[model samples]
Target: KERFISLTIKKKQQDVVRFLEANKIEFEEVDITMSEEQRQWMYKNIPPEKKPAQGNPLPPQIFNGNQYCGDYDSFFESKESNTVLSFLGLKPRLASNVVLQLLGQVTVVQ
Candidate 1:
């Protein structure tokens, strides 16, 4: 599958401030801008589904040599550490078969 994230947002301190200032309806100066309460007010007005979820949700992130890294598959399963890794088709990268145990049970990965 695809690696980690579907969307990426990068922000720098001053750049974010400048962008916010530019978006402000009547503000030409970044110094005189909206307060936190004002921004929060705007956010609260948005619908629940329209509101931000605030996290990355992606699947089966594979690295070079097809090494997949993710936590979605961790739910519901109880296999031995090495056995779990073997089941996921991760025989090459994991040395000494160190499968990270979860819920005091099944191994997570190689």
Candidate 2:
């Protein structure tokens, strides 16, 4: 799944971008303020219930491929749980480290 985020040039949007960059996450940003068509398209694709409670229905909307993954809060939650990698169809590096540690614990009898 490709990582995509819809956002305007707002402070909150910038914060999300910063967070992703700090975590070394790759993502494509669609600036809704720059493109009305994109803004409208985002609105049409994301259901009202899924939209933020602010009622503006504007950006910072995060998505994994075509699936809407909520705004910054949701993204943060996924990040905290280390599920964002899985959502992007990427192998979880942390899990792999854990697996390797487990393997290292096993000692074969001579």
Candidate 3:
């Protein structure tokens, strides 16, 4: 059972990383296993309502700088809804805007 949980956590973390990379979003991966400080920071930053009732929240917690974005499940939901940028507190770039930018036809107004 423990092994299964470990594999599941790795898969979720990989999914999050893959999504971020595919979108060209810059991110830092923290290894909580290697750093107690980071682990505690993650735990401390998670909101009370988001914590699991039985144990410390698992890995794949998303954050934008110091702000807690959400866990993997929340990330997956936002991805499915096509709101990942907003979910990560990022400015959403419309598909049309991207095409225009590629062609140098217009400047994207933030």
Model 1 agreement with the true structure over 7-109: per-residue lDDT tens digits: 2111222232242235341112211023544233333333455333883222211111223222323311313243433444445443332222111122222
**lDDT by residue for model 2 over 1-110, one digit each (tens)?**
11332222255556655655675655444445566676665666676888667765545555544455566566567778978655433464421110000000110101
The clash count for each model shown is: 0, 0, 0
**What tens digits encode model 3's per-residue C-alpha lDDT throughout 1-73?**
9889888877876677677668765554445676677677778878999999989888777666567778778
Ranked by lDDT, the better of candidates 2 and 3 is 3
Candidate 3 lDDT score at position 101: 10
Which stretches of candidate 1 lie above 4 Å from their native place? 1-33, 55-110
**C-alpha lDDT of candidate 1 relative to the true structure:** 0.28
Please state the error at residue 78 of candidate 1 in Å: 50
Which of 2 and 3 is the better model by TM-score? 3
Q: What is the C-alpha lDDT of each candidate?
A: 0.28, 0.47, 0.63
